[model samples]
Target: MAAANGRPVAKRRVRLLGGLAVAALIAGLGVFWAVTAPRAVSAERLAAIEAIEADPARGERVFWAGGCASCHAEKEASGDDRKRLSGGLRLTSDFGTFVVPNISPHPDAGIGQWTLDQFSNAMLAGIAPGGSHLYPSFPYASYVRMSDQDIADLFAHIKTLPASDATHPDHELKFPFSWRRLLGGWKFLFFDDAPRTELADGDAQLQRGQYLVEGPGHCGECHTPRNLLGGLKTDQWLAGAPNPEGEGRVPNITPGSPSLKSWSAADIAYYLESGFTPDFDSVGGSMVAVQKNMAELPSADREAIAAYLKTVPAR
Candidate 1:
């Protein structure tokens, strides 16, 4: 009884059922996420948002502070390594390796069309524009504190960047690790929706510096070692962590550490600028990548970051 193609109606029904089955499978996966995914904001995050006006104009600066572009961007072959913001960089880990996505302003490929709520959910909730969970590599836990206004502005600025349609490489995870649903349990244990604690006596500059380091710079994400479960070891904040990407462990940059005891905030500031320590030795590994972002920051802001680091409870 097929009228359109003159094919058997029974055959058409079978084809339609097959297609619907696949769609059902995908939709079921999405529903599983909707039920199991973590979603809870802590009180501390709220206080930080109250302090700042959420202006896209200012959000641009905060975006830079978070170093959103550095990890997201592809590294160039040149020694100086230009091409900021455009992403194709590969990040390797024991569980997997992920090539950064092209977060550029490409309308079809990038975040150009993402709604503000979508952007906020991505940053704060660790959920992509759809209800799907983003890989933890995005560090949404640290970014959860970003005010809605600031997130909105950051989204706007990202939309303005030149788009690169370079496709992102698939993450190569081992077994259950490759499964996104496996991350739901990991999130339950490690992900904190609480925003950062704002210092009342801390001046605006100090607060800004803190936000940059803890939120966007996500310096702690790498520098601060995590427990077996992947939560930052609260007792050993910023002491040092196993270098997931490199051979050697990430060294402690805290002032209390012997390596940094001789150095002043000014020295750290200079090192961040030149990628060279006071002893004229070059710093390497992921830090080199971070310095690339730091180098672009204003001197005063860099200084502010330096001053803040100097006070970080040593080791």
Candidate 2:
């Protein structure tokens, strides 16, 4: 009789322990969901962004400054064709191959239907219209620093571009990296919109340069080395990095860099405008496209970029 009673007690203990384990699992899942959920721009901020008037003419400047065509336009597109914005570029990285999507104004294949509010959210918060997180490969991380007016203007300019039905395959990422929801945690750790470098004395030219480089130009995205988690190493800002695409290295543009140490501010600006370095080496490789974009900008903007590069800490 005592053995029979002890068996029942043991069974009840097992049931209690199993229930506790299930409860703990549910709680853990709840925490994971909460942490990985996408966060859009707040309604109040969206309202302010909407209040700004958009100008396509001014946005054209932002377009060049941001180098949208470098990735969004066709790889072989040139001259007027560059305005098509039919994205088919393949960006290969350690994570996987990220095919650039069609950002043209087509209603279905492109973002033609995305409202200004949607665009603002995508640019500033890295959230998609359907409330999914966008992969940082889109460079919205750098765009997060853009001003509301600039974002509005960029949308207007993009709307004016010719629409394309061009489509590309979805990103091919490895397991775990393939999961989009996990990006929420990544953003929480490294999605900083703050200025990467603080200018001394708040000089106006340096400030403009900083805005162009950090906000729209996104030069550091390539120049700065990333951590194991793909976060930018702030300490090495604009110091050359291993080329994510291949074996070579992105040259260091900081003042202390040997390659650029002797380059005068004028030399830098002239190279950007003319695609010829101080030593008369014509721009080559991936920078060929970037130099072309820089040539289209006003001379003053290029000079501002040069002045800013000269001031950066030598890496």
Candidate 3:
């Protein structure tokens, strides 16, 4: 049998089967590519949103809350050294060693040229200026919860940091993980920019605490255990986990946990402010850096964090 324009047609059934297979293949490829494609923060949306004038003073507060200096400051730096945002810290993990990038104000080396919009994308959306996916190691996943005003202020504060010409080597990651584009696939599965928690109307202090705990503070990134794919187990929240960077265990902050059940909210606040456990033991490990950051916060903010933590369910 011959069709009007075809040389020959074996059978309509054969054609239908072949066409279906081709369609399925195309559909599969399309889905694969779509899931693998990296997404960027919408520049148009960023532009349309009204940003408050950034205040360097306010940004200093945000900087402390976000703990930017812990990672960006020179390794083993103390005192005045921490003010310099010349990143060279080496973070180790199962995936590989990540060499932190320079985030200083140096035009050639740092993010000096990055626009506010680009910084927002980097901090909140985990997208770089050139639209590359930043690893969750940078903790932008938690930063996503930060307010627009905070982001603006933080950016202004960062700009005021002294410029450094220091350069660091690229992240030394193993196969597949070393590929930056592969992060698109990871982002598809885990990256979410939505609000992590919701609070009732009013109660400004509690609300501020919630923002700090869930946002720039990024408490869960360390405290929450991760799934096999490296996504945080939100159900567990801050129930604690084995540290991926080392052998130490990340402590559970939820009040329900027997470990922290004895400690009152005031105890938590005091610890945050002074790095002294209820037992009067000094803080250590990765938390040392975090405690230093928390200490910089006002006593009110620290108390607010404690108040918010008390509201969380014990695991």
- Report the number of the highest-TM-score candidate: 2
Model 1: per-residue Cα lDDT over 1-315, one tens digit each: 347666667687989999999999999988776656755333454344444455666666766667776677666333323333556777887677776776767766677677666666678878776566677788887887555666756776676566767666577777867877667777777777453333546677777667666776677788788877667775676788888887788878667877888988889889988888988999786677678678877887788777777767777
List model 3 lDDT by residue over 239-290, tens digit each: 9999877887999988887778898989999998898989999888888888
Model 2 whole-model lDDT (C-alpha atoms): 0.90
Better of 1 and 2 by TM-score: 2
How does each model score on TM-score? 0.77, 0.93, 0.90
Worst 10 residues of 3 by lDDT: 1-10
Poorest 10 consecutive residues by lDDT, candidate 1: 76-85
Backbone collision count in every prediction?
2, 0, 1
- Which candidate gets the maximum lDDT versus the true structure? 2
Candidate 2 residue lDDT tens string, 185-255 = 88988997888987887888888898899989999999899999999999999998999989899999999
Q: Rank order by lDDT, top first?
A: 2, 3, 1
In order, the Cα lDDT scores of the candidates are 0.71, 0.90, 0.85
Two-way TM-score contest, 1 vs 3, winner: 3
